[model samples]
Target: MPTLVLDTLVNAPIAIVFDLARSIDLHMYSTKKTNERAIAGITSGLIELGQTVRWRAKHLGVYQTLTVRITKMEKPYFFEDKMIQGVFQSMDHQHLFEEQEDGAILMRDVFHFRAPLGPLGRFAEWSFLTVYMKRFLEERNRIIKAVAESGDYVCYC
Candidate 1:
């Protein structure tokens, strides 16, 4: 299992930032490039533990679908999602948010994933998947930061 972690200091309140993050609509906006968006289930309202959401997206020019279930939920702080069934062998992502003295937020993303194959998996990771995942997560963070800093709950641009 390889773990990839990416953290960002966002210029926004913890609650607002967290709310924006949990919003699927905003996620669609942020991932315009990846063609990622929530298609069904937990589309709106507060996301709680055990809630599951279906995701559809295009990665590497191919459409990919996955259902993720919330495993942990702590208001205005941290939440985690585990893939019920997806392309990868396994996936667990946790998002954490905290407030700064200036009222901004510190957002962190931690991901753990296992390649499908065994030793060949390690080779694939070393060859491409690792870098791909890193770029994917980094791009996501960039969009999140943009959405948070924009001060608009909705991404209009």
Candidate 2:
């Protein structure tokens, strides 16, 4: 399993960050390159546990549809989504938000992924996906932090 953990401080309230993060449609705005569109399921409001969302997007020139559902939810604190069916063999992402001093928020992401080909998959991750994917998420975190700090509604379209 390849795991990535990233943490950042956003100049926003924990509730605001949590609310924005729990909305499935806001993901597209947060991501930098994964230009996704929510096709089905909850498009607005906080995504509750067991709620699933489908998205269609072109990743690396290949069109794909990913369906993910909330596996865990803890108010303005933590939420985890599991990939029920998607491009990867397995994917689980946990999003966390915490109140910090001076009224800022600490946001973090933890994701685990497993590929199908075993050793070949490890090799592929070492060759490409490892840093590539990590940087992708980091960039998205930056976008999310920017938007949340600005306290504006972003168009994920």
Candidate 3:
């Protein structure tokens, strides 16, 4: 398994940042390059605990469908989503939010995932999947930060 962690700072309210992080619309917009879309379940709006979402997207030149369920949520502070069905053997992503003294919010993402195919998967992770996933998360966080700081997050949330 590989773990990827990232922290993004946003000059916005924690609640707004958290909401945007779980917004289906915002996620779809952020991943437009991959043509990612919510194909079933909670297809739009904010995803809550126990809600599952099925996403269809093009990655690595192939189209894949992934289903994830929000396993835990604590309002504007924390949330956890785990993969129910996807290409990976297992995937868990934790979103944590902390408010700064300056009113900014620090959004941290802790992602853990394992690839299939045993040794071949290990090689993929060591070679490019890790980097690809990191870049993917970074791009998503970048969009979330931009939307949160722009005061236009209300539309997505």
In model 3, what is the error at residue 77, expressed in angstroms? 0.3
Please list the Cα RMSD from the true structure of every candidate, rounded to 1 decimal place: 2.2, 2.2, 0.5
Q: Which stretches of candidate 3 lie over 4 Å from their true place?
A: none
Q: What C-alpha lDDT values do all the predictions have?
A: 0.82, 0.80, 0.97
TM-score quality measure for candidate 2: 0.89
Query: Which tens-of-lDDT digit does each residue in 74-127 have in candidate 3?
Result: 999999999999999999999999998888899999999999999999999999
lDDT of 3 at 51: 98
In what order do the candidates fall by lDDT, top score first?
A: 3, 1, 2
lDDT of 1 by residue, 1-157 (tens): 8889888889976777787767777667767887887777886555678888888999878999988999988988999999998888999999999887887788998999887888998887788888899998888778778777877755532
TM-score for each candidate, following the candidate numbering: 0.89, 0.89, 0.99
Among all candidates shown, the one with the greatest TM-score? 3
TM-score of 3: 0.99
How many residue pairs clash in each candidate at the backbone level?
0, 0, 0
